[model samples]
Target: MSLATLWALGSVGDRLRVAYRLLSKDLDMQIETTAVIRNVQKGTASGDLTTHGLEFDQLDPAQQMAMKAFVFDRQDDALEWSHGAR
Candidate 1:
């Protein structure tokens, strides 16, 4: 998703912990990841995520965008963890 989408979703003030599945177009592989909102600034929202046992920033750009788009689009109705349970 775009920065505009993140803003519309009120990401600046809300802590959104998200999980998403991403399929690599080239590798034909699927990855599941989890991210926790860290901060938002200058029209950009950023967070820490672990995918395939690697930090989000360590992943390729395509993987990063895929995760961001997936989470941003679903944050509104997304479920949250409650006392360690969803």
Candidate 2:
């Protein structure tokens, strides 16, 4: 997410709809979901930017399963890597 996304989302505990586009060599899909802003931290990102953690809510069962599968597929990577585009 960008700085604008952070600003538009407001503070922690806020609920927001996020649009996600997943693309790869053979796959493309878009998902829209609501997420709860779980945490925000200053100095956790580059320069003066802040980082936020979101907990997804009201997910379609397939969406949730796909996300879990994606993360599991990359289980060897750093935990933060899977946060992208979701």
Candidate 3:
């Protein structure tokens, strides 16, 4: 199982559908999924946006693949950036 957490700068309902874009090669990739607000708290900021911990509740097969690709891509970037190795 994978964990999904989203910190919104605003209020989100208990359950909602969200669509977001990721860095896709040669194309704009947008993934949609349904999530539920599990917890809300303040982060390192002073603004109207309250951090909300979101848990992904539903995702189709295609969506899962896209998300996995996105996560892996991001992880690779982090590793390369941190280790100064491209």
Q: Sort by lDDT, best first.
A: 3, 2, 1
Q: What C-alpha lDDT values do all the predictions have? A: 0.40, 0.64, 0.65
- Stretches of candidate 3 off by over 4 Å are 1-13, 43-45, 84-86
Backbone clashes per model, in order?
Answer: 1, 0, 1
Please give, for residues 1-86, the per-residue lDDT of candidate 3 as tens digits.
22234445345456767777766553357767777767667556555445567778877787777778877877777897899665
Task: Give one digit per residue, the lDDT tens place, for model 2 in 1-86.
Answer: 33233333567889878888654433356779888888776664545556678878787877776666655655634455766534
Best by TM-score: 3
Global lDDT for candidate 3?
Answer: 0.65
Better of 2 and 3 by lDDT: 3
lDDT by residue for model 1 over 1-86, one digit each (tens)?
12223233334334333334443332333444433333444333364322121133244577666666656545532543233344
> Top lDDT: which candidate number?
3
Q: Of the candidates numbered 1 and 2, which has the greater lDDT value? A: 2
Root mean square deviation (Cα) for candidate 2: 7.1
What TM-score, computed on C-alpha atoms, does each candidate reach?
0.28, 0.63, 0.65
